[model samples]
Target: MKLVSYKLKQKPSTLRVGFVMDDKIIDVQEAFLQLPGHSTEMEYMLPSEPNAFYKIGIPAIEKAKKAYTYVMENQVEEISFHRDEVYVATPIPEPSKIICVGKNYAEHAAEMKSEVPDYPVLFAKFANALVGPEDQIVKNSKTNKLDYEVELTVIIGKEASNVTQEDALNYVAGYTIGNDGSARDLQKRTPQWLQGKSLDNSTPVGPWIVTADEVGDPSNLDIHSRVNGELRQSSNTSKLIFDIPYLISFISSLMTLKPGDMILTGTPDGVGFALNPPQFLKGGDKVQLEIEKIGRMENEVIEGEFHY
Candidate 1:
């Protein structure tokens, strides 16, 4: 099911959780309200935490499904929503930390004249950088060489520590598209890429999160990025030097990964930095990132005068 967080016209201040059915959202709460005694379970699952669903939402959904099924059987209400009316938020907004992988793709490593690391190259972005799919990515004056890195980001489903590669995926809640927008000049100025990467509104994520069951074999998906209408990067996740399972296990070994924490699996070759003249993003450029099965994110670049 394509689970999403959105604000309805009736409740603009609060986010509502629901499954995307056709065009209309299958209001999970409304569905439960129609149920006999599952209202408490719905309340328990209403916390903004995405992992709560696994602990409470799923079971509640299962029970509610029975009633919904009956409703469907009886033709109580059709499952359709008008796509244009709802304001969509990140499937999990305000995640604690956005962990990102650097140069996990072999060709990407080669393009930057770096060796494919035997271990995963981990970095992080602050939560303030997180924005939903349609949000604008600000290009500040400090960054003349703005670039886009299309990546497959994994959303953690539960708190994890010392997980094994074999059991790593079990900790994953789902997957989403992550555009690791970077200021190449700033990134290279310091050994740490944090400054260039963690700029506000840098990480444009979502369209929506697809559950792990729906995105089986995460490494097999096609990941690509385009500027305006031109394709700049196209590669499969299979080219990843460090796959999802390894990343989860590796990161978990070092620190605990809580639910809503995300991991960007790195980008493919063909970043603007690899070009002879380095194609950087300017104000008004549209960046489109598409990951097979996950979804697509289209962001417009706007100039921000302040530079740090």
Candidate 2:
């Protein structure tokens, strides 16, 4: 099953959690209420915020799945919505932690003139950097080099610490698309990538989350990115230097991997900074990223203002 976070045009400030199937969005709360022998107080069983819903662990997923089943069986239309009638937001918009993997792809490592590390090279992005597929990547004038890196991000489903690679997949909620937007000049200006990578509105996280059951194997999936419909980076997740299971195990060893934590598996080669003449993103540029099983993300760049 696919799940999404959306905002109706009328209710722009409130983010609504939804269950998406066949391009339709089902309000998880409303759908749950329609189930036979349902309780009104049980509405609290589901949270409007994606991260909070995830924090409840398996119950959250089961609630949506049950709702989906009821909707399909009863053919309910009142609880359903057309996909385009709302604005999509990042699936886990307020994740507890946003851990990123750098140079997890060998070619991406080569293009950046960096060596593959023995362990996962990790970094962080905050909630403020998060944007949805429909949101614009604000072109901040602080730096001139803007780049895109399409990554298949893992969403944590359970609390895990020091788990073995064999058991790591058990704790994964599912997978989704992520664009690790960066400002190269700022990145190179200092060793800490937070300034370059964590700019506000830079990271476009999702159209929705495809549950692990639906996605099956997280490895060996086809992932690609494009600029204005022209393909820029194309590769399979098989090329990841550190695959999902290993990443989870390794990262968990350091800190507990709780539900709602996002782990970006890193990007492949063909980023703009590694081009022939180095093509950086400018206003009006459209970036698109797609992953097999998971959905696609298409966002445009617009010049943002500074009120200093």
**Candidate that scores best on lDDT:** 2
State how far residue 181 of model 2 sits from its true place (Å): 0.4
How well is each residue in 248-290 modelled by candidate 2, as lDDT tens digits? Answer: 9999999998898999899999999999999999999999999
Q: Distance from true position, residue 308, model 2, in Å?
A: 17
Give each model's whole-structure lDDT.
0.78, 0.88
**Model 2 bad stretches (over 4 Å):** 11-13, 42-44, 305-308
TM-score of each: 0.88, 0.96
Tens-place lDDT per residue, model 1, 232-292, is 9999989888889999999999999877788999999999999887899998999999999
Model 1: how far is 121 from its true place, Å? 1.0
Q: Clashing residue pairs in candidate 2, if any?
A: none
Per-prediction RMSD in angstroms? Answer: 3.2, 1.8
Question: In candidate 1, residue 196 scores what lDDT?
Answer: 91
